[model samples]
Target: MKKETIKAGQITIDFLLEAADTNGAAAMFEFTVPAGAKTPLPHYHEHYDETIYGLSGVLTFTVDGKITDINPGETCFIPRGVVHGFDNLKQNDAKGLTIITPALLGPVFFREVADIVNQPGTPDLKKLGMVMAKHGLVPVVPKR
Candidate 1:
């Protein structure tokens, strides 16, 4: 199957399978975040669970305000409504597989984010916020 690719901030996301095809059961993707990349700000999903399985390099995750470092073969789960975010904190590349359960609107949000940031000008944060809201992705903290 052909994969959908998106550049969300400092990372490249390869959507292997979207939840749309799975009837909102799950969405899967492999993501590569460059060294020192700042990941998305802390946020929580109102209706879906998210999991990140480490595939390569180091990823520092902040889950519910607690920081933890994830290495290869490791996994972290963020239950629905739990605030969390992550970043590639090492000097090498960081890669992981992300899976969202009951994956309603995650793909749409990422696609929109890629489009907004890849354009020739400054991305519209207000527009992005609307998209998040539309998808039930509620950001508890401001983007850092």
Candidate 2:
């Protein structure tokens, strides 16, 4: 049981268990977002289903065309192919555990994002998006 911490933009990800270490069955990570932090753009995982369990504060999750407020101790799921994303909109920070099944791309995506953002200079948005695309994520256009 090895753990890794990765910084992606304004989020801190603690890899609890990687799918690769589990034969591609599942991956889990603890995510912490600071107050007023930025969030992943709206997107969908082409091959993995994600389940998120709130651990502290509040997080706003958007799936399909709906938005739900996830509070402490609550959980939600987004099936593969659903347009989804989340943000911490509360005055305090938010933390949660996210699990991805079928483990197709979760670990890779986090690693790439962390690498890109932790580099010497500013992170290239286009490059990050390309990396995400290669790992089976489709970024959705944000609503106006």
Candidate 3:
């Protein structure tokens, strides 16, 4: 099957190995984060662990209130239920490979999110939250 690419805002995700390819064991994808783009909402997965391997540039990740910059050739493991978010604050785009266990999330989730995110004007937070919740990603609201 042909791989699918989903674009949500300034980020592009190419689905490399989906749940079908992995028999539900895992799903792998490559993502690109453009420089200067707004960071994704901090969120946590309640059902699957995620591992990210940096490919180029740097992906600055905030996990459970701790910030870390994952540079090329480095990796970060995010256990389930750990609130995490990332951004490409460098001058160049950051690329990476991500693998999630149990393959619970696939193109459908991203597609749904992309639809909401790519819409004209500001996206509806309530709808986005609903989609994320349906996919087991719980958004984290920052404390003032």
Question: What lDDT score belongs to each candidate, Candidate 1 first?
Answer: 0.84, 0.87, 0.92
TM-score for each model: 0.90, 0.91, 0.97
lDDT per residue as tens, model 2, 1-144? 438887887899888887667798988898999999978889998888999999999999999989998999999999999999888888999999988897775656788888887777778889889998998898898968
Report the lDDT of model 1 for residue 32.
95
Q: RMSD for each model, in Å, please?
A: 2.0, 1.7, 1.2
Question: Residue 5 deviation, candidate 3, in Å?
Answer: 1.0
Q: Which 10 residues in a row give candidate 2 its minimum summed lDDT?
A: 102-111
Ranking by lDDT: 3, 2, 1
Model 2 / residue 126 / CA error / Å: 1.6
Model 1 lDDT per residue over 36-137, tens place: 986776789998898999999998989888898889999999999989988887999999999988767556778888777777777787887777888888
Taking the tens digit of each residue's C-alpha lDDT, what string does model 3 give over 84-112? 99989899999999999989989999899
- The residue ranges of model 3 lying beyond 4 angstroms of the native Cα positions read none
Give me the displacement of residue 115 in model 2, in angstroms: 2.9
What's the number of clashes in each of the models?
0, 0, 0
Model 1 reaches what TM-score against the true structure?
0.90
**Better-scoring candidate (lDDT), 2 or 3:** 3
Which candidate order results from sorting by TM-score in descending order? Answer: 3, 2, 1
RMSD of 2: 1.7
